[model samples]
Target: MFKNSPYTIYGITALILIILLIILFSYLGLNLYIISYLISINLVTFLYYGFDKLIAGFESVRIPELVLHSLALAGGSPAGLLAQKLFRHKTIKTSFQMTYWAIVILQIILILWLSF
Candidate 1:
């Protein structure tokens, strides 16, 4: 049933590309602090998504999608995807998915462009 799943491919590809880029750049002036920053930002993004999912059924205010998208754009898309997969959140909204995938693709493009 998972065959032909674009999500699977996208996730796998993104992970591979990220790792490769990190390794590549680490020798070309990338510092541990930058990696730490990515890790920290990703952790925050992951927590935010989880928090939003937890409060989804409440009558209280919700975490805005814009914030989520912004987090993803700021080097947290991987964590965002992980949160979506783990918590089963934001997977059903086609518009949100579109925006998310677009952000991911943009990140990939930016990385490739900056690599050269």
Candidate 2:
């Protein structure tokens, strides 16, 4: 039952696509590869949130919050926020919100520090 879930399919699809992109990007310059990786990760992250929301009421296993946060930390926080608003998922839970915001803030700081 769990293995046949749409989320599993999504995960597999995303993984395959990401791997293919990585292989393609390897032939490209580092800057281009970095950009492609970021875009892919964000797209995957957005889909993950939507999928998690879709499965919220079902008995099927939901995407773990840790995975969500890890994705955001991997540079998908903007997509995470967009997905939260678009899917109306993970916006109300105070604990989750706090942690998410913290991650965002840290990312912002890291970016600013790097830009200096």
Candidate 3:
């Protein structure tokens, strides 16, 4: 099914895994803190997509640009990038697109920085 589009396959599988993880956590009555963290991450991911779309409309404003970076910094970079690519919503010839990817790269560096 995914022979033509590996990205779609990976995205769908990742989404199913997230849902299953949530269900398992809920079923097991896992720690509230962990659940909260998961929820926050999802919220950020959702907002990142929305903000990316907004950038598509306005094509201005550095604040939204920074929020994009911060969302990535907050650990939603991979999902945000996937959404942008899959939706083809923000891929264009503009600083917004350039900055968004730059932020993604920065987020990865920050994550690695904190991890190591």
* Model 2 stretches astray by more than 4 angstroms: 1-17, 24-31
lDDT of 3 by residue, 49-107 (tens): 66556665674432244445555565566666776676675567488677777876786
The sequence of per-residue lDDT tens digits that candidate 1 reaches over residues 1-116 is 74545444434444555566566667667669688558756877788789889989998566678778877998899999999999999999999999999999999999999999
**Positional deviation of 62 in candidate 2, in angstroms?**
0.4
TM-score each candidate.
0.72, 0.79, 0.48
Instruction: Report the number of the highest-lDDT candidate.
Output: 2
- Model 2 scores worst on lDDT over the 10 consecutive residues at 5-14
Instruction: Give the clash total for candidate 2.
Output: 0
**Lowest summed lDDT window (length 10), candidate 1:** 6-15
Model 3 alpha-carbon miss at residue 102, Å: 2.4
At residue 54, what lDDT does model 1 achieve?
94
Q: Relative to the unseen true structure, what is the C-alpha lDDT of residue 38 in candidate 1, on a scale of 0 to 100?
A: 86
